[model samples]
Target chain A: MKVLKGAYSGLIFLFLYAPIVVLIAFSFNGAKSRGAWGGFSFRWYESLAQNADILHALRNTLIVALLSAVVATIIGTAAALGMHHMRRGLANFMLNVTYLPVLNPDIVTGISLLILYVFIGINLGFSSLLLAHITFNIPYVILSVSPRLKGMNRHIFEAALDLGAGPVRAFFKVIVPEILPGIVNGFLLAVTLSIDDFVISFFTAGPGVSTLSITVYSMARKGIKPEINALSSIMFVVVLLLLLTVNIRAGRDIRRRAQTHVRSHSPRALSSREH
Target chain B: MSELIRLVNCVMAFDDVTVLNSINLTIKDKEFLTLLGPSGCGKTTTLRIIGGFEVPTSGDVFFDNVRINDVPPYRRRVNTVFQRYALFPHLNVFENVAFGLRVAKVPKADIERRVRESLDLVGLRGYDKRASHQLSGGQQQRVAIARAIVNHPQVLLLDEPLGALDLKLRKEMQIELKRIQQQVGITFVYVTHDQEEALTMSDTVVVMNDGVIQQIGTPVDIYNEPKNAFVADFIGESNIVPGVMHRDCEVSFAGRVFRCVDTGFAPDEPVDVVIRPEDVRLSPPEEGQLDGEVLSVTFKGVHYEMMVRARDFTWMIHSTASEPVGARVGLSVRPFDIHIMHRAEKTEAAS
Candidate 1:
């Protein structure tokens, strides 16, 4: 049974990552063709570094993702805070409304945003793409943050006020610290999703505002570019590093919280350190 | 002691249900007064009103003879040790204790000195670096107390601060709390449902029920002279039986006329008779005032608790002697042991 379970997990992992493994391996190939691996070399990477169009696309992707993630996180966290204090029924209604953007098909959101921008007489370019990314990224941020707010002790806010801190000071000193991990997680999720998005960017992004994903798609339409493989490999490693840092920090937080919970409930063992 | 805080006809109604109905109370400086009652009896509501957490629906709250109904909690010189010890989880012991001083913008040196002094008062010296979560329930409770007292408020409100500890820890903290209150020399308005804790710690005990103050007096006064059946039953174990007040110091119950140390009732008026369990003495069936069959008996460490059914009412008697089940026993009470009280107009059974 143990062997079978191990085999099953191994097969699943292989099936999931085999294609990425092949793409990464090919990025180091000297050959220009996908099927023929004429030994390993850094020729494709060297070309990818000097490719102005691809580099420009990479710059656009980073700018759009970072800017949209920041704006979306601020708006979404404020909305979540507002909704956290609402009456239960109203809060539930608003939460369901917030879920609509995440649950709706990306194509639908993209087309609707495109049509709205055209009708509103706004030019479709980098700003339009940025707006679209922010709009879609907000729901992810709110979804991540609302649970932290719910888990918070409701009395801490009142305790802060009772202890001589005003409302604004209490919010920053106590409430923000309590929910900060969730905010950071939401921001990371927004950045990842905005970078990975393609369907929405394709519709909302106008001429000359090509993101990395859109540029790859356009290059793939003509012919599979060997330099694109190197680009994807670097992007994957960057995302992997980002996720590792987040997971490590989150693990430390959970462990510290768990230790506190255990200590609070354990049998009262006085250390005899009385004055 | 002088009056430091007063609630004048304070009424708190949340939506349609009234939590406090025209509560009028005066708290004295350096007095340890406890609000004792079961849950939802408005004891907590009264404490919150004084803490500036709740605005009275239609009445005024006075602190130092100044009406502070509109004053917010931070503006009031009062702090509450919450029931759950709502210590800031992100802060260490020293920082939690120093929270109020930091917000008040006190000097850094003064804040450190006061924080250390308060921690020492709570017997938690050298624990300033420990996080709030790293402490046991008793330690957390001490931290909460230290946090509240470090501010040097004129009055400190504790909402059942020891309600979360185990029996042994609770007993220890009860004494610890009393000593801390005296050392701080601030008026402490404590709230709890435990009558024994109230009796042990408070200089004055305020018994409340159904959003109204049932009785307010010293512990001995509240115990020995309960104004009504609810106060008598709530404060301690008592067998409250109905009786007729025939004349001064005379009442009749359980098919016998008994003399009590009470008077000023209308002639032939119905009254409630309160008899403490420990005060009832056991005697021979023929020699006692009332006789009954013992239904059950259980040893309660210091005393044996026996339930005796006599006439129409069951009496709880605590004695050093044990009476077996189904045994015939006689119960006798002295005239001073029988307390007569005016029957409550709309008495609901004590919870």
Candidate 2:
């Protein structure tokens, strides 16, 4: 039964990755037609380097992702803190409303934001695109951070204040450090959503401001370029490298925690000596 | 000694649910005081008010004859050893202990010296570099104590600082905390739900329940002469029975009139009578005050606790000897052992 379950999961993994794997494999194809298996070459990678349009979209994607992630993290974490101390009924109501943008269809949220921007007479360019990205990203940030705020011990903050730190100092010294893991998680989630977004960016971005996802969608109309495949392959490698770093760090933390547990309960502490 | 802290007419209601009701309390300088009560008894809320974490709804808190109602916690001359030992997880023991000193902007050399001294006092020497998670619960508690004491606050508030420890460690830390309190001569206001912990470590134990102070006295006074049935039952094992005060030095209980020392009640006034478990003695049915049947007997390590039913009252008796179940026995109570008080409005039935 266990082996059968393992085989099932393996098949599911292959099904999810097969297309991306094929795309990456075709990025090395010497021929332009992705359907035919051409001999391996770096021709597409060289062409990808020369593709300035794709480069501009990539730059736009990075800027939007970075700024939106940071701004959304600040706003969302502050909102989570405010909700942490609110009355249960009101907090529940606000939390339910916060989930509305997240649960709604992405197209609906995108078009609604676009309509609001147009009504306000704001041009649909970098600023509007950034604002729309931040608006959609904040709900995800709040969802990830709210649980951490709820789990924190309220007395810990009071302890910080009682230790002679002022309210502002205590917040930075105690509250921020305690909720930092949640904040980073929220920021990373926001960045991924912003980078992968197409429907939202397509609606809000003007002609000069196109993200990588929107660029890919537009390129699909004209025969998809081999250089786009190369770009996708590069992005896959970058994401893989990021995941590798994050997983290694998380594994180290778990091991360090286990080692600390063993050392503390080791019958004799051996007194961690400092010279 | 003069009062170091005074809470006058303090009333705290959180979202219309009263947690502390018109509490008037005073803390003397250089004394170890403990607030002892069950959960939801408002002991912790009172401590938070003194620590300046909560402003009472309609009362003034004074420190050295100065009203500090508007003063924030950082400006108060107080530090706290939190219940869970809220040590900063990101900092090592040395840094956690030095946090208060650094906040006050003490000289770096002095901060180091004081942190070392406080850690040494808690017998956690050489634990400076250890991370908070790298220490055991007892060690974490010690670090918390060291951190609070390093600031040298005029008053140290401990909110059940030893609530999370094994019995042996809890006992050892109780004595250790009392020793540290005396050594520093800092007014320590400790809160705990454990009656034994409060009695063992505190110079004065204030027993509170239902957002009101039941009684405040030394351990001996509180134990030997409880003000009401709640104090008697909460402090230790007791056999409480309804009785009537006929006059001064006279009372009727267990279906018989008995002489007693307590007085100042109206004639034939219904009262609550308290007799400690150890005070009830056993003898042959022919040679005692009241005859009863032995319902059960159980060994309680130091002594065997036997339940004797005399008339309608089931008396808990503590003795070294054992009587078989269903054996006829006589229960005796000396007049001096019987403590009486006017019946509390919320009478508690004793089993």
Candidate 3:
């Protein structure tokens, strides 16, 4: 049974990541031919370094990702707070509206946003792309944050208020800290989503505002390039590092909280013994 | 004595259903007043109204002769130690206690001194830096108390504050709370469903049922002279026998005429006779007021609870003596121990 389980897990891993592995392997191939694997070489890495358009697109992608992540986090946190205080029916309705952009197909959202921009006579550029990314990214932030808000003990807020801190101060000193982990997780999710997006950007992004994903698509359409492999490898590594750092930080924070909880409760056990 | 807070004909309704109806109470300064009731009897609702968390419908809340009906919870000169303690998880004991001071914009040095003093008062002197989430349930409760008392509000409201603790912890905290009340000398409006807690802690006990004040008196007065069936039943364990009031100070129950100290009831008025378990005594069959067979005997740590079956009803009597099951026994109750209350109407009975 254990052997069967091991084989099943192995098959699942292959199904999930085999394409990515193949892509990475091909990127490192030193062969002149496209299909055949070659001995490992540094040609792709050098070509990737010299690519100006790819670098520009990467910079634009980073800017858009960072901007969207910040805007989404602020708006989503506020939305979460508003929803947390709202009546159940109204909150749920608002949540459903926020999630519509996420649930709808990318093509439909992209087209609708394009039409709205045209009707309003708004120019589509980096700003428009960032706005589109935020529209879709906020729902993920809200979903992530709402649960954390709900999980938090409401007594904390009441306690702060009772202690004479006004509503605003209590939100910053108590409510925000309690929900910080959720906020960080949501921010990371938004950043990842913004970075990897292509379909929405394709419709909203104007000339000279191409992102990394757009650059990758255009490059792939022309033909496979060795430099593309290096770029993909770099993107994969950066994302993996970001995920690792966030997970580690989150895990540490959880452990610290648990430790503090245990330590505080332990003194009672000691006092009982003394009594 | 000056009236610290008063609820005049206070009525609270939620979704067209009355939760608190016509609650009239005047809490005196420096009095430990408890609102006692069974679950969902609106004791908590009344406390919430006084704390300014819930506004009474069609009534007035007065604080020191000033109408406070429109006052928000933060603006009320009262603080509540919520049932769950509600200590801020993010703030340490010091910061949590000092939060109100900071919000009121007290000087930093004064805030620090007051926070330290409050923590010391709660016997948590050296643990000020510890986060509230790290504190034990009892410590969390003490922190909650410190948080409230540091502000020195006129009235401190406790909504079953010790209900979450275990028995031993609750007892310890009860004494601590009474001591804190004494030291602070503030009006305390405590709410609880536990009769023992109310009896042990409060100077005045207000027994309530279904949103109405049933009786308000000293703890001894409430326990000794409950005005109605709900008050008698809720204050403690009582054997309520359906009976008829024969005349002034006389009630007949279970084929026996009993002398009671209660009055002002019309003759032949249907009533319920209340006798606490500890008030009834067991003796030889011929030496007591009534004779019955012992249905069961339960050994409580300090007393033996004997269930005596008399006629169609069973009387629970608390005694130290062990009695064999099914043995014939005599049960007697003193006249002063017998409290008579008019029987609840059919609608009240169903509730």
DockQ of each: 0.49, 0.38, 0.43
Worst 10 residues of 3 chain B by lDDT: B342-351
What share of the reference contacts survives in each candidate? Answer: 0.63, 0.52, 0.51
User: Which one wins on TM-score?
Assistant: 1
Candidate 1: tens digits of C-alpha lDDT, residues A26-74:
9998999889998989998999889899899999999999999999999
lDDT of all predictions, in order shown?
0.91, 0.88, 0.86
The CAPRI category of model 2 is acceptable
**Which run of 10 residues does model 3 chain A get worst, by summed lDDT?**
A266-275
lDDT of 2 by residue, B203-292 (tens): 899999999999999999999999998999999989989999999999998899998998799999999899999998889999889999
Candidate 3 residue-wise lDDT at B196: 94
C-alpha displacement of A82 in model 2, angstroms?
A: 1.5
Provide TM-scores for the models: 0.96, 0.92, 0.90
Which runs in model 2 stand beyond 4 Å of their true positions? A1-10, A35-38, A240-275, B348-351
Ranking by TM-score: 1, 2, 3
Candidate 3 has an lDDT of 0.86
The deviation in Å at residue B96 for candidate 2 is: 1.1
- lDDT of candidate 1 over B152-197, digit per residue (tens): 8999999988776777788899999898988888999999999999
Pull out the clashing pairs in model 3.
Answer: A163-B100, A264-B134
